[model samples]
Target: MYIIFIGTGWFSYVFSLVNLDIYFSKNHWDRYTNFAELSLHILCAIGIYIGRFLRFNSWSLVTQPKHFLSILPGELIGKFPLVVIVLTIAIIAGLYALCKPLVAKSSLYRE
Candidate 1:
């Protein structure tokens, strides 16, 4: 959790230092940065989903908020199919993995 916060903080700090909008507009280095940023955001989303399901509470909120905003601009690139599919898969997998620990001791049938 602490590690996730540190990583997210570092990623945001580095992202703030660059002119990503302008870079994309000029077609200079945007492809690499966009892919990297997308990958990172997807991972963060998965992390947040897992944390929430497991009630981890640490660094989940910090990382989760960015997921909504990041996906908006992502649509502009017309790189939809792959990124969306990957993110969906990641989220589903995270939820499934987290659910086991969370639901393992819970009763499925009401007695």
Candidate 2:
């Protein structure tokens, strides 16, 4: 139980950053891209929580779409989910901010 929970948390955090890094490299910075990335992070965070707490897998979502959709609103409306989602976003944003400087520095060095 401990390992599964902790692993889910760590994997979600790193995967979000990797998604951002991939987008940053592929797409030039733009307002729309920024918004898209943020939304993606939020959704991923929420999905991670659902997977961790509800014990649902990707296949579960596909196999039981109605069941999956039904639970999402209940989860989203509650305080616990809201707090977890917000914290996840904040963590991802902070990580991006910290890494941005390093990426910029390295880009300069590459030139």
Candidate 3:
């Protein structure tokens, strides 16, 4: 249950990063893309933490929005959320560093 949610979050976060890169590069703002990508990663990390700890998934924004909204304010400002976001970002960044070398060396990015 929890594992599934975390897995989904991880996939969504990584894909969002790739999409963000494509978008920024296409727009010719490559210089600013890294900052934007990191920002989004931090936000997604917080979102994932909220879902994991508060039991509020993304659809809650459409279905049970009030429940989701009610908790968001406090959660976003809390020390716990900060810790979770920082830790999540660290993990994601480390994974990216590990994978980036392999990805760059591969022919996949040659296009």
Highest TM-score against the true fold, candidate: 3
| C-alpha lDDT of all candidate models, in order | 0.50, 0.71, 0.74
lDDT of 3 at 60: 87
Model 2 worst lDDT run, 10 consecutive residues: 102-111
Per-model TM-score versus the true fold: 0.29, 0.62, 0.72
Candidate 1, residues 9-31, lDDT tens digits: the string is 74443343233434664777665
Q: How close is candidate 1 to the true structure, as a TM-score?
A: 0.29
Clashing pairs in 2: none
- List candidate 3 segments past 4 Å from native: 1-23, 108-110
Which sequence of candidate numbers ranks them by TM-score, best first?
A: 3, 2, 1
Off by over 4 Å in 1: 1-27, 59-111
In terms of TM-score, which candidate is stronger, 1 or 2?
Answer: 2
Candidate 2 regions with alpha-carbon error over 4 angstroms: 1-29, 103-111
Task: Look at candidate 1 and tell me the lDDT of residue 44.
Answer: 60
Kindly report which residue pairs in candidate 3 clash with one another: none
Q: What tens-digit string does per-residue lDDT give for candidate 3 at 41-67?
A: 677677778889888877889998887
**Candidate with maximal lDDT:** 3
